[model samples]
Target chain A: MKLGPSRFLGRRRPREYAGGGRKAAVQLYHVSKSYTAGHYALRDVSLEFGRGEFVFLTGPSGAGKTSLLKLIFAAERPSEGQIVVLGRNAPRLGPAATPPLRRRIGVVFQDFKLLPRRTVEENVALALEVVGAPRRDNRAKVFAILKQLGLQHRRFHHPLSLSGGEQQRVAIARALVNEPEILLADEPTGNLDPELTVEIMDLIAQTSTRGTTVIVATHDYGIVNRYAKRCVRLEGGRVVEDAPAHGATP
Target chain B: MSRAAAQLASFLRAALRGITASPLTSGIAIATIGVTLVLLGAFALLVANMERMLDDVGDALHVTAFLEEGLAPEAQRELASKAATVEGVASVRIVSKDEALARFRGGVGRGAALLEGLSENPLPASLEIGLADGYRSASGLARVSGSLDGLPGISDLTSGQDWVEGYLRAIALVRGIGWGLAVILALATLLIVANTIRLAVLSRRDELEILALVGASRAYVGTPFLLEGLIQGAAGGVLALLLLYAVFRLVLPGFEFGLELVLGGVAPRFFTASEAALLLAAGSGLGLFGAAAALASESRP
Candidate 1:
């Protein structure tokens, strides 16, 4: 049956599944990433994340949480694994293939990696611009996203002029501007107050309601306890637990 | 908009943004290029004028052969005829000794009475022979002298060999100096262009890196800088042309009368349209290559 324009068109496609129901958004089978011969960031890790899943990656500073996020974003390749992101094998795809994959995934770095010279509006507009959106549409979409993030008033101000919380909001606005199907945040609230931390986590949880899968990597246990979503706990490069926060133990 | 037009617009906007970000540095670069181009233009004019002057001097000279004192008019005529038949000789004119004395008296009219004490005309009849352009060299004149030395009535075969050799050597030296100056100045021009481009690129490195991160092709990042280089070069070339014109105009009037007496007209020291066009093309090419080299060298992983 012809069902209008495919929802997956220009959106993230589902990852391939052996038994398909709601196919996994991200699937890593026996994945291992090693920078050098004796050092492996992730070792034989097998995991699957279904569509619209909200998961927390908790681990100590050097426990491979960041590495796992990097792999998902196609920033780094696995030495031995099948990393399928939105149905495309990460290792098989070359440099040219990464941009399109990246366009569908939103990334909020821990350092709020915003261009200091650009205004808040411009920072958010970059995401839309990268995806080849029309100029007029990009302007309107960026403004709307900024207004939603409570940063419309500071649109003309550069990131350096903004407070930490405001800068974090701008970063979030930039990541979510393109309405990416997958949102990846690394230490999104590591520098925020308890109230601000809950607010950021609530915003992430709300985004998953709109069918956007959110994966946040952090060392903050307080946030994971409060949000109480599916937690993928890692210790020393191995997944110690992959289960729902308040569900039956597995 | 068409695809190329859209791309061009994007590049233009980006270049404009870059220039706005650092106007002082760009201005300095443009001025440096202008000065270099002006020097090169002046050198070109000097070479052109020197070549023209040499050509004029070579064309005006000839060989003059004096006849023996006891030679008859018939013998002188036969000798003139034989000299004209020489392979390198273009034309021969025979002047009798009496005619020579009369010409000398006319030249020094007030001193004519001083010459009356002479028993006879001291001047000897001479045959002046014009040499072809290819035979105007010292070696060629030597061949002509060998052919005419044994002819009847010909006592002395004197050509302007010394003067010709001196002029040839002077021209060769000047040409060598001009070439050396051109080479040194061209290298200076290249260095100036390269440094200017490097500064411009350094100022825009952040923008370039951002473009790369966004998946903009390398060509997209590089085309505007190349265009900027071409614009600077063309502007510099025109500035050089104007500066040369001004200098020539200031100096030309003072030399007009003296030059007219020497060359029969005022000599111009400016490039013709075709030559100016060549200078402009060369300047633009140099600028483009300099920018390309800077880009290639600075683009690292």
Candidate 2:
């Protein structure tokens, strides 16, 4: 009630989270979210995304892929159950407390969500700026991240001037600039061509290799088939398939 | 640079961008604040000068105890000594009938022949009383005058207390009206400025959503708006000061006769350095508060 630091008393790690003796990065216990009465975006669903895991949330429009991602990021509270992310209860955090938690979890979107007026470097530096990173170091870190994404030359260009693939890279650069522990992308390549789709997904997949838990909510099965990764398929607000990936690549 | 300085730079950049993004709205807010402060500052100056004039008048406290006509010189002298001992009376000097007549002739320089026709001296011998510092106000004047009223040798007592009281009342009335005007205008200015900033904030709803998506806190998000308001307000204050100074210098001297009648030999003046700084600070305060109000209102629901 005080909106202070939370002491979650009942966080005894469940059996589902204890995979290979490591706790999950994200866990939901029958979480349900409803925007209105008798209607739900996500209902009676439970899932776990482990540290350094790459998971794809595949479902049709309104199948709650976005809702599940929203719940994990604390964008909206679960109506029925608890969600634990980065050892903190997502539902218990207040408006003031949410930012610190969000700082550690990077998010990307289909629309890129970049401030159009700002250049690529400025947009990417937003993550560091929020944490009060010094300007010299902020520039250095932004440069390093943009370079990693191969968009360093375009850092000074505005997002509006960038191609769809390039804008998504800017978004990914911002998401990875902080080296967040958890990366959630809501349809990161939804607007790109088949060729650019592979390019963007490769960057996001690379984040998981660096021990960042990456969740990409997408409806594209072609990209999912290309990579052998754990895939959670949702239908009518319920998870009908939770298939763990067989290998890193097929 | 330090982390704080980096954050400060970020906030200032955003604030400047916000102001530049909507120059017309920002300019309107600044102008309204300037106009409001100008009116308020003028009233404050008037009240300050009036109070100073009253202070000067109070320092020259003088009371006259007009003695009964044909009183003996020895009796008048005795009465003067007794009056000096009265509470609140600092000193007394006896003005004989002949001296009073001579002073009257000097006062009416061109009309001395009007008094030359008089058979006997019409002026009475009196005691000129100087009041103590504590007895310089209206209440003190009344207390001292009452004590001398029924004295055997004195026919009447008169002092400047009555006229001072009337003038003080007039000053109070003007001050009251000034404050009333200030309150109404301040409220109007605050509302307009608040709405202007609110509209500005609302226009950037998309940017805010993105900031939120990137995990920016409420303070982190709202600080730019606050700074924008503060800059606008301070600019407004500077504007008001310049306008007031211009009016005081270029326009005030044109009404020299009116100023002389009201202020006497006292120079009509402009705001001192500290007073001008205070006006600027007030404008900044209005702008800062207006932005805060806008942020608070927008946050609700």
Give the per-residue Cα lDDT of candidate 1 at B94: 91
The alpha-carbon deviation from the true structure for residue B201 of candidate 2, after best TM-score superposition, in angstroms, is 1.3
- What i-RMS does every model get? 3.4, 1.0
> Which residue runs does candidate 1 get wrong by more than 4 Å?
A1-57, A64-106, A116-121, A124-184, A189-215, A221-250, B1-3, B16-20, B23-28, B58-92, B95-209, B227-243, B251-266, B273-287
Which 10 successive residues of model 2 chain B have the least lDDT summed?
B260-269
B1-301: candidate 1 lDDT, tens digit per residue: 7555665776666666655666776566556666776776766665567557656766766778888887877877888888889899999999888888999999998999999899988999899889887887777787888888888777888886786677567657766766786678667766776677788788766655444434344575677777766666776677777777888898667877765643345266578899988877767777777678777877654
lDDT of 2 by residue, B98-193 (tens): 999999999999899998789999898889999898898888899999888888989988899888898789789889988999889888888988
Alpha-carbon shift of residue B282 in model 2 (angstroms): 1.0
For all candidates in order, the CA lDDT equals 0.75, 0.87
Q: Which candidate has the top score in DockQ?
A: 2
Each candidate's TM vs. the true structure?
Answer: 0.70, 0.93
